[model samples]
Target: MAEIIGVIEQLWRYPVKSTGGERLDSVEVDERGLAGDRLYAVRDSAGKLGSGKNTRRFRRMDGLLRLSSRLGHRLDGPELFDPLGRPVADPTAFLRAYLQRPDVALAREDAVSHFDQLPVSVLTTATLDWVRGAAPAAVVDVRRFRPNILLRTPPGTPPFVEDGWFGREGGGGARLAFVRASERCAMTTVAQPGLPHAPEILKAIIQAHEGRLDALAEVVTPGRLSVGDELSLN
Candidate 1:
């Protein structure tokens, strides 16, 4: 029997990197990803992708981003706010705020522009447990992974092994489609504050879970999602 789970969860579109993400009760999905997901990004002084990928060059970005959003009418054009909860700026003041920190440096601020690895990342609680059981030393947390959707499935259900291919109905009757599995990198090794010390959690997941613990999906087709939308396999 195919079981259908109600609306799982909703994550807000966090445009900035490193700071914090906003949670939402409902949201609209789009092709690029959630309406506001990765809408903005940071660059090194020399205009390089300022993300965890090249931590040595932009390690300051590790804990410097802040993102938030509010209710809006259209999913295609929903407005995004800075970490301060202010409207998006013309040149984007958020980057300046991030660069002011001493830990951050500039090779050429205008020369780099790095987007997040994925527009919106999603993971499941079951997946976390699976990794934990396989690698006792691994301590997986949603924040460390920085996923946008954290669906809670049945206890016996498997982890989010194939999130890239799953789809569900939104409360507003929109359909969310899974696009592809997420490819991991070295950044996963970095520690998130307050989480247990499992420096190799990312490596552990790659070793045990067929080298994948999370997947990246997009709203290939626009849809509305609520807190309790039914989850369906594609």
Candidate 2:
């Protein structure tokens, strides 16, 4: 028998990598993960995707988080918007001017994945409360963590409860298998709209929790999921 753990509080989909995403009341989940999630990205001259930290496949591109993107009716890609909510007519030119990188351009994800790690990322309200308690002075917001699914656990539920779900399958409609704890990065400290520059947010996770705050997951059964759906461990 499966045990009920929590209800889905929010769903997020990032059409463009390393940018702000849109909240949804409901969304479709596929084998690739959330539909339209990270289908596009800012690519540099060296072919590295834009990200918060420099890696083998990712290049640290500052100010990418200030941008927001959403999936339009087009199947080709999502529509990019600037920090001020204005639509971008030319993504390549806009990205070049915005990031001050002459060789940077917008591109879609190909055979290689655009995700930082796993296909999905999950966070719980209990962990948020823990972070707030740990760093009372820091502004702890869900946007800083950038989870694809936000679960609202019942009262009295312990923080970091998602850690136990690793190697377990759970979801409301779309089945997901928790794989590993999502690692924190320097991106969490970057200031964005309605968020302030707070490095202490990442510091609290590192000092108290070893820099992990959420769960990274992979889709086991593709389906539709909605806010308020009950989640259980199977």
Candidate 3:
């Protein structure tokens, strides 16, 4: 039987990748995932979605880009801006400014937009602990995983076990069950703000553990979630 360990401790939303994220008091989930999570993304002129791979050519795309979120009554709604502000129509310009890339500014149509993935990427505390134990050198920041939700699960369990969770909890709140373990990419290996040797540490953990150092769960239902909300399972 599955067990409810703890409520979600941290909720994060990254309007864009590589850029910093905002901690949420609460968040809404839609069919995709977290709302305002990856609503828009920068696609190249050829209409290919940008992945962290092949950084040799698209080096600018690998760096952090900033974004904000605003809650609208509907899915196709206006986004709330973070303290840093939102990217207007020309995202490439904003990307150039954010990362100081003159040649790469406004390079695409949705250059400064969110991706189409579910807005929320949820992770459990148990997963965090498991990772911490495996990779002590890992800074373990949410940005490393780009997750929208930082959930707390049962202790001692490895990351991604939540891939099997389903249905509403015993209490009353909605449940965004786990669908599958997120397949990680080279991005997890990038060095970032709090972590300098991120790639080396992630490689070590992957060797000692199983695959990547962390896991992500998808929200199955569509609704709003707050930080202090209680979570339980039967």
RMSD of each: 6.0, 1.1, 5.3
Off by over 4 Å in 3: 1-3, 54-60, 65-91, 96-120, 154-172, 212-218
Candidate 2 has what TM-score? 0.97
Compute the lDDT of residue 175 as modeled in candidate 1.
48
Worst 10 residues of 2 by lDDT: 71-80
How many pairs collide in each candidate, listed in order? 16, 0, 23
TM-score of each: 0.67, 0.97, 0.68
Q: What would the per-residue lDDT of candidate 3 be over residues 141-160, giving only the tens digit for each residue? A: 66677666566665566555
Off by over 4 Å in 2: 72-74
Expressed as tens digits, the lDDT of each residue in 18-77 for candidate 2 is 999988998899999998899899998889999999999999998988999988445577
For candidate 2, the per-residue lDDT at 217 reads: 91
TM-score of model 3 relative to the true fold? 0.68
lDDT of candidates 1 onward, in order: 0.54, 0.90, 0.53
lDDT of each residue in 1-234, candidate 1, tens digit only = 334542466565554444445677777776656666555445544444456556434444554434433335443433445545676653234455645643232222233333344455657767867766766766665666667777776768676645535453222345444556666665565654455446577667677655665656545456767677666653
Give the C-alpha miss distance for residue 78 in model 2, angstroms: 1.3
